[model samples]
Target: MTHPIDSTEFASLLCSRLCHDLLSPVGALNNGLELMADETDPDMRQRCLDLLADSARTSANKLKFFRLAFGSAGGFGDAVPTHEARVAIEGMFAQTGRVKVGWMVGDDMLNKLAVKVLLNLSLIAGDALVRGGQLDVGAEKRPGVTEIVVRAEGPKLVLDPELRAALAGALPPEGLASRTAAAWMVRSLVTGRGGEIVLSAPGEPMLLFGASIPG
Candidate 1:
């Protein structure tokens, strides 16, 4: 068993995760605005406009994805459409263009908690593809169980040992960092509900995640 995280501390950690992901694009937006204000050349001004637009889109995409993955999305529903999740995931990777997403979820709907687990795991798997590779996410519902798999194949893949430890509940709660918060959340949510999460060995060319949850 892992040490339980304090509610206040966990919330702070999650906030850190959100800010870290948003910082780059959000900062870009600010910088673009500053450039636009001083630029006199028409062509350079247009370039600034392009930068602003791209930053805005990136910010929006991240927010939308986080809304569903971490916040209250599909309000009041016990299940959320799998399609929505796919769109959210696609939009997030769309910004980079290097990472390609292959969604293979056969189920039309997933329970709220299952969807959260899928998205969080997908985020971690997607991040492992540092060189930007293929991400395949799939989930299936059986009579009494639901299984989810996230696989990443790339020229170079790295799953940090700290993240693996957090996902396995081998890291003490005090050791959890903002970078590994999502993995910790996945482990906590799945194991708290009596589910199990499997991870491929670190440094492998391909990274795979398997999660099983009882219905």
Candidate 2:
């Protein structure tokens, strides 16, 4: 069984995860700026400018996604519009040209916790698509339960075993790392609220994630 983590440690893990995700684009932005400053050729300068723009956009997209997924988005509102979650997911993967998303969730709203679970699961699914692929997300609310599913298909899909353990609430708190933090967070949120999470194994051609929570 996974042991409970103190708030400070959990927050640190999340910070590490965010930093790791943003490092690449932010580093590229710095490199682009440096190149633009040194290059005298007009074409090379223009290329640097373009790279900077892409990096800026990527950085912005990641912040937006993380704000909703890991921050206090939706504020005091009890329910967040479904479109907002959809847009957040789309923006998160926008820079990853290798991945495509099929959003099957409807226009109805979702509670804050539900949205959190959805986005975190989507993040894991998208990351599993190592060679770029399609990710489909769907959620439905019926009476006492809410159902969420994320499916990923690509040329080379991998679901890390440690991540699987984290998602299953089998990974000890001490074993948590930046790579598996999101999965751990998702599992904590779902099961904390009397919900259950599931994932497809690594060897499968596609990665599938499912969660059921009390409505």
Candidate 3:
């Protein structure tokens, strides 16, 4: 069963999740600036500059990904170019240097809602690869429906029960939190369109998520 969440509360949870994800890199950027200001050695100063550069890159990548996943990224259009989403996903995992993304989306464009669901599910699957892994993202449009599939495989994969529950639309509204906001959003988006989500078994060697929504 799908539990209804208030719009205002859901927005708050998303905001909190965004802030939490960006905090570490943003804080590193600030610290790097402070260190550069006080450092006298050229090598140390150079190191600080390098830190700043990496932090800036990470922050930018995350913002780009989140813009598409959680915000209005493709402007006011009803459809967004699939390449943009491909780039966003690549940039997102590039920062970690631990996960490789394989994009198999054949469509040139996807509806805005489909883009959001794809990105969010990809985000969840990528995060499940605790010890770094391969993430495969694919989507297809057929007849009157859009289908999305995300797969994660690694030596160590961990998908939290709460997130799984949220994705399955079995988590209660009162139990919602920032960590599960994206999963819940994916659920809401799919179900709102009279769609359904599928998940691999808990003990499976790989983590998989699939969604089919009527367009």
All models, RMSD in angstroms: 1.0, 1.3, 0.8
Q: What is the C-alpha local distance difference test score of each model?
A: 0.90, 0.89, 0.94
Candidate 2 Cα errors over 4 Å, as ranges:
none
TM-score order of candidates, top first: 3, 1, 2
Could you say which candidate leads in lDDT? 3
Candidate 1: the clashing residue pairs are: none
What would the per-residue lDDT of candidate 2 be over residues 136-166, giving only the tens digit for each residue? 9999988998999999998998888899999
Work out the TM-score per prediction.
Answer: 0.97, 0.95, 0.98
Instruction: Give the lDDT of residue 171 in candidate 3.
Output: 94
Better of 2 and 3 by lDDT: 3
How far residue 192's Cα lies from its native spot in candidate 3, in Å, is 0.8
State the lDDT at 61 in candidate 3: 92
1-215 per-residue lDDT for model 1 (tens digits): 55688988888899999999999999999999999999999999999999999999999999989998899898998999999999999988845888999999998999999999999988988888889999999999999889999999988887888899988889898788888888888898898888899988766668999999998
**lDDT tens readout by residue for model 3, 82-187:** 9999999999984578999999999999999999999999999999998999999999999999999999999999999999999987899999999999999999
